[model samples]
Target chain A: MTGSAVSATALIWVDGERASALPLPDRGLDFGDGLFETLLLRAGVPQFQHLHLDRLAAGLQRLAFPDCLDRVRNCLQQAAGELQDYPWSALRLTVTRGSAPRGYAAPADARPRVVITAAPLHQDRCQPGAPVALDWAQLHWSSQPLLAGIKHLNRLEQVLVANQLADLPADELVVLDAQGHVCSVSAGNLFMLERGQLLTPALETCGIAGTRRRLVLEQLAPAISIPVAETHISPAQLTAADEVFVCNSIRGLQPVTSLGPRQWHDHSVCRALHEEYVGAMSC
Target chain B: MTGSAVSATALIWVDGERASALPLPDRGLDFGDGLFETLLLRAGVPQFQHLHLDRLAAGLQRLAFPDCLDRVRNCLQQAAGELQDYPWSALRLTVTRGSAPRGYAAPADARPRVVITAAPLHQDRCQPGAPVALDWAQLHWSSQPLLAGIKHLNRLEQVLVANQLADLPADELVVLDAQGHVCSVSAGNLFMLERGQLLTPALETCGIAGTRRRLVLEQLAPAISIPVAETHISPAQLTAADEVFVCNSIRGLQPVTSLGPRQWHDHSVCRALHEEYVGAMSC
Candidate 1:
């Protein structure tokens, strides 16, 4: 949320207590041995809380951490309850494998940690902005099936791609995997409209399966009379698509108007789906 | 270093000061947006200090952080000076893009942070253990050339692999890239001896170029007339080698005696190189 009158209260919690800092030995900072969730807190309530927690649970299982899903839910609920003063806010939750010895070998008795941070968001921040300008990213995502679809803490590729966006005159950049397969935008899931069907690149080998993208494919599109599918997409295929949009929890759905040489003004499908999704969220 | 006498005067430095905690918004913890170095501290001196710093500088340049090489060196020097009481120890240095506003896009005025943590090691921890038993890793390394050969913070893959090792009776496990190319062990670099030359996987696509691996390839091998090379190694090639060994800064070299059904007892060359490297480091 940007450029709106907003009163904010920021809170940081480490393992369920109000705290200002994290230990230096935290694996989250040391090895990025963690997962995080960023969602909207509307009127002191977390939106899509179940969906976000589902992803976090899946990531925790994939990383082989001890079962702490119940504790995780409590942490989120506690954080949301603490931000009641702010009418609207952004909430973040991070879970790491706590601290460990000085090597990759995990300690026999590892305790997973949950850190929660919430900051106020302007009421108008989620309003869809102008059609985003897009370009291709210079860097490529690594193809690791084991890490695919989970929002783990290892995100250096996104950081590098974000750096490239500073020099280019574009709002977002399309990222491809090491094999040159169209993956997603630098920070969100991408969907392309082709022949009246919505297609998102399958993340079997790489990329995150974002919560908003999931809702659009499974809920919004079906209600709005559009078919959705997941398949392999190449850069050339992405360029040839009739329309495209990027979706994430923070920004919802953003329509793309241009990608370097190619340009499109038809955002009718994107607009329709976004409108329905927002309507559902507001309810 | 476990079970032995470890008089650890643990030091934690956030930026340059002695601090026990880090800010919650540090990108290193948030998104693994950083790099790290772990070197040996023997007799109050950092082993391979130049090599580790060189790699750290290259990593900083690649990550597009401001040139803080001098500051990093000063931090390491100061940390080392404080840990002089510990006879043997392991030192870790983490450099993150400081604190940032929420999101993948870095702030225009981002400040880089250097964190140093050191813990004492048992004097006998460095003693080469019995031949290691290895099995294939259930997880594969992502082939991201952009991140290959650099020690970055995004290490969830290693965490996953390490978890797998716990169930199996193995000291370490061999990891492969998505395309089935032999990569490295979960915690260190892999080198396979074949014919007369030492062959390790080429890291043009993935894996870290460890400081000890560099010393073995560039220094010990040439000095002892054992040729070295980096190539695309397959599981078949790794299994067919005359001998295989894993190396890292903390542990000089560990001979791999068994890999599933295959086994190797010849470690004369490995013992020679490790002996020479240890003698040189002690000087």
Candidate 2:
């Protein structure tokens, strides 16, 4: 996720035309006034396309971007089809409030710009047994209940958290809200297995409501007969869980083998969820 | 700030050259992983250049953006020089973590991108005795202490707040934090004259640390003998103040004449501060 490894022709589109550059005054670059979605492409088709598009549409509504959901959905489908040569890939969809004259206030007639980028995806990252090590992020997430659950472009906190882990011997960083309740891992939503119930932190105050986490809660868990709940999770509760895992659209489900001194090798629950998610993706 | 009103040729620079577009993979557009400053250009020179650059430098350090402050400053000066025809103008300087492959994680070797845009400024917005009506913003600022003060590019909250005021008669919107404490106005830092002391909300948890607000606390108040303090301010305290005003680099200082029902016509304090700020900016 951190390299320039895309040697193949990465598919890119700006407002329906194939372009690789954006205007200097684009509001997305100016104020991060936009929303984005990252989807995993399996056999040239985006897995969980409906969930990703739905979240993007919701984000556009929240940001008051123009009603162009159908155009965006079509762009995503068309882009994915064009990049179908790769068996597996990653697709990113971004909808910005378009370019604007210098300012924080978005113009009333601003047309939303859509930018899509597709790259090859590595399948090994999602393998269940290949758990990732984690550490507490040195930085804390800001408590903006107004922005807690949506995947907007204002992600400086994530960038800061990820930067701190650059020198640490960890694959992921567990971030906390201003009040210090467990919010999320650096790049995904967190879920803990405790007393036979699947629990993820409530995103009312922080963290992105990841698409894979939604699938687990709304579909996969029920299909697999695992009880799920969303609630405030303290650091102590997270460490004390029998097993812990994180999920995002790109990386389906990865077990946390270690977080600082705490470690969990029993990833049976994570494996089951990953298998279910993968099976569902294929259909 | 919302309209496309520049009739003169606006100057733009990207990475030190005259350019009007950026590579689509820029992380600033992708994740809003950057900082920006909008400065007022008076007589072909950027006013408060030192303060604005210092703030941008501090933001870069906090966001872990690559250290390129000197280059950014030089670019600002160079770009502003190219657009010197307008006696009054606005210059926006942006520093992003450059472009990266699709992901939240920063590429270790990422080069920083610097973009500067210069446009004509309207003189009427800064008239000394012009008092503006205000209303409380329905949208609250998210509490992220880590990003509370710096002028980062993640400004969707400001966009949302301003959008709500589009149809309202008020000239500006007073925003509060998630905890209901007075935070700031929709676009600038707020100051209140209470009991002979000029009080501004502490930005420890939210709001941008505006450059003009900084100038007031650091220079104008001290030179004018008006005591200033930064502390937790509530709505009750704001309404009870003898006078209320807002400040930013572009608009200078403006007195708020009305807030919903409470009205104040006193221009003594705001006029004094505005005079001091104007005098200081000219030198």
Best candidate per lDDT, number?
1
Tens digit of lDDT per residue, candidate 2, span B34-149?
Answer: 88888888766788888888888889888877678888877887777665666788888888899787777899888899888887866744467457899999888887778879
Instruction: Give the alpha carbon lDDT tens digit for every residue of A1-283 in model 1.
Output: 3344233434788889988789758888888888888988876788888889899989988877788889988888887877766667888899998987777767878888898887887755456645798999998888788888999999898988998998999999999987789999998999999999999998988899999988988899999989999998988888899999998887788899999999988998988987787777742
RMSD of each: 3.2, 3.5
Local distance difference test, each candidate: 0.85, 0.84
DockQ of 1: 0.77
Indicate the residue-level lDDT of B260 in model 1. 98
For DockQ, the strongest prediction is: 1
Question: Model 1 Cα displacement at A149 (Å)?
Answer: 0.7
Model 2 lDDT, residue A18, Cα: 78
Docking level for model 2: medium
- Local error of candidate 1 at residue B241 (angstroms): 2.0
What is the lDDT for A263 in model 1?
A: 94
Candidate 1: clashing pairs of residues? A1-A125
By DockQ thresholds, what CAPRI class is model 1?
A: medium
